[model samples]
Target: MNSATTTTTKSRALRRFALHATSTCATQAEAYGKCILATYTDVRKDACKEEFAKFGACLRESVRLPRK
Candidate 1:
């Protein structure tokens, strides 16, 4: 495949992976979303750090490749 085609294919694969990971971690995603929304008006840098950390951990676990 050409460079452009290769790039497009990789992008699509990444998008699909992200969608799958997020869906798998839906509960963590919802918690993060709720935390953000609740503190939208006066959000600080670490306002939702705990929620975000949990979401990040979930996403990492969801997308982890199985061992051979």
Candidate 2:
């Protein structure tokens, strides 16, 4: 496929991972923070920045999950 398609797929995966990590966090806040970074930082910087912001806004406004 093309670069746009590839980026979209990777960004979706990153958002999924971030949500999973955050949702499954235990008592420790640091662990959750680390998980967010490990799962999303580079992906957001590379190809998911716009999508990430949209995802985050939706996440905050409601319980809606990211679209595939």
Candidate 3:
């Protein structure tokens, strides 16, 4: 393949990665927010913490991001 073609392909790949990462991060944020609300209003703190840990880890692994 030509250099120009390869570069275009790479650019597309990066854009797709950015889109997926952004979406995944947003989902993780929402889940954490809900978990926090649940902890405050109804759920046990330790149970909520465990749920957060498990869910957050799954998301991070999927997107190759560190737990923030």
Which candidate ranks first by lDDT, i.e. highest? 1
Cα lDDT of model 3 by residue, 1-68, tens digit: 66998999889868766665567556655676787876676656475676567556755576564569
**Model 1 per-residue lDDT tens digits across residues 1-68:** 56998999889879867885678788888998999999899998989999989988887776677789
lDDT of the structure predicted as candidate 2: 0.54
Which pairs of residues collide in model 1? Answer: none
Instruction: Order the numbered candidates by lDDT, best leading.
Output: 1, 3, 2
The Cα local distance difference test for each model comes to: 0.85, 0.54, 0.67
- Which candidate do you rate higher for TM-score, 2 or 3? 3
Residue 39, model 2, lDDT: 70
lDDT of 3 at 39: 66
Distance (Å) between predicted and true CA of 63, model 1?
1.3
Error of 3 at 43 (Å): 29
Instruction: Tell how far residue 12 is off in model 1, in angstroms.
Output: 3.8
Task: Provide backbone clash counts, one per model.
Answer: 0, 0, 0
RMSD of each: 2.6, 13.4, 9.7
